[model samples]
Target: MQNLARAVLVLFGLLVLAVACIAVSIEGSEPSVPLTEEDVIGTWQGDRGARLEVTADGRARLSDASGWRCFKDGQAGVFTGEGSWIMAQHSDEGPGILVKFTVDGAPATQCSDHFAIHRADTRDGGDVWARWLGTGSKEPYRRTPTG
Candidate 1:
């Protein structure tokens, strides 16, 4: 009886040690690399044909075909109904560019949908855009007109 109890205790200890080792290993693992602007520079088509694209030379072009516009890093342009944007930084959230339009024309931060844009719909849209490729998710973004 004594040996059986000791065996069980030993087994429990080993299990606990193994679990702790695994937890530590997981915790020590490196964080995932943040997506960059270059990774998100391409035409992105949404469910409703909402297309967005970031060019290689640091230009963001978005439009609904009938209506299209572009902007540069320090540049700003009209968005949806009453919105505009000013390109910003490229952070871990993804290649981010500042948006200045409606919502008060305040600086709106937009990250590349490729990294962690959340919503599956958004991700799908991003996939269509394909900006998350070549770019390292750390490249600068500038809004520039297509024409």
Candidate 2:
């Protein structure tokens, strides 16, 4: 009985910790600057070979990126494809984007997925933009990280 009671306590503690982590991720994701469409017009890279190229004319391309709203119909290899994006607003991260993915030039069904955006608070002020990949982790694809 004592061992079971200890296990319950441990599980409860873990649950609380998970919730706290989510809260922090959402709260601290505030944008450092007022993000515009032009601000995100650059190539943002993240860990694990993820690449998001945003062009000035509302074109976007993703390579090995996640938090995707497409590929719902057992579509494979569409992760690395062309798409279009527009400036959007997220409740947690404020200014965001909706990347409407496409598979070989056709819209990939309601690909209008919302993702968070943030800017790094650096001294260099390099106008870096970060795309929040709110999957199982909080990974940011920052553009031009300079010292």
Candidate 3:
């Protein structure tokens, strides 16, 4: 009976050690790098064939031939907006880019204009991922080739 109890205690100790190692590994990971205009000035494709275009002058356009269902106000199709993007430190997720824009000629309440973009470590060949801040919808976007 004593030997069995000792074995159980040793197993519990090993489990605790494993958990600690995983925690340390996650905490020691490096943060994401900041993005610049060169990094984001291009077309990005989202889920359901949606497209977002960012221009060098800080202008942006969101277009979907079907619709942007996330908009609660039922305004869909195309939207023209302008805003600047910046690389900032996220409190929990390390470095990320914040995109702030407003739909042109739409009510302020109809649009949730903030988004977060982060570099996806799992991707190669200049692919990044983004999420809408209000609806929590995520999508992967690849840079469109430019000449």
TM-score of each: 0.32, 0.58, 0.55
Per residue, candidate 3 scores C-alpha lDDT tens digits across 1-147 of 999999999999999999999999876654345556676778877765667787777666665524443344665444445456555546665444565655566546334334456664533554466655443244445556788
Instruction: Sort the candidates on TM-score, descending order.
Output: 2, 3, 1
| Model 1 Cα lDDT, one tens digit per residue, 17-112 | 999999999776433444455445454554444455545665454444222222235343333322233344435543344422222233453422
In candidate 3, the residue pairs with backbone N, CA or C atoms under 3 Å apart (3 or more residues apart, or in different chains) clash, namely: none
Candidates' lDDT values, in order?
Answer: 0.40, 0.65, 0.59
Per-residue alpha-carbon lDDT of model 2 for 59-130, expressed as tens digits?
Answer: 887777644435555443325667788888876657778777665444544444565665555346634556
Q: How close is candidate 2 to the true structure, as a TM-score?
A: 0.58
Lowest-sum lDDT 10-residue window in model 1 = 127-136
What is the lDDT, from 0 to 100, of the residue 39 in candidate 1? 41
Candidate 2 yields a Cα-based lDDT of: 0.65
Cα displacement (angstroms), candidate 2, residue 138, comes to: 4.6
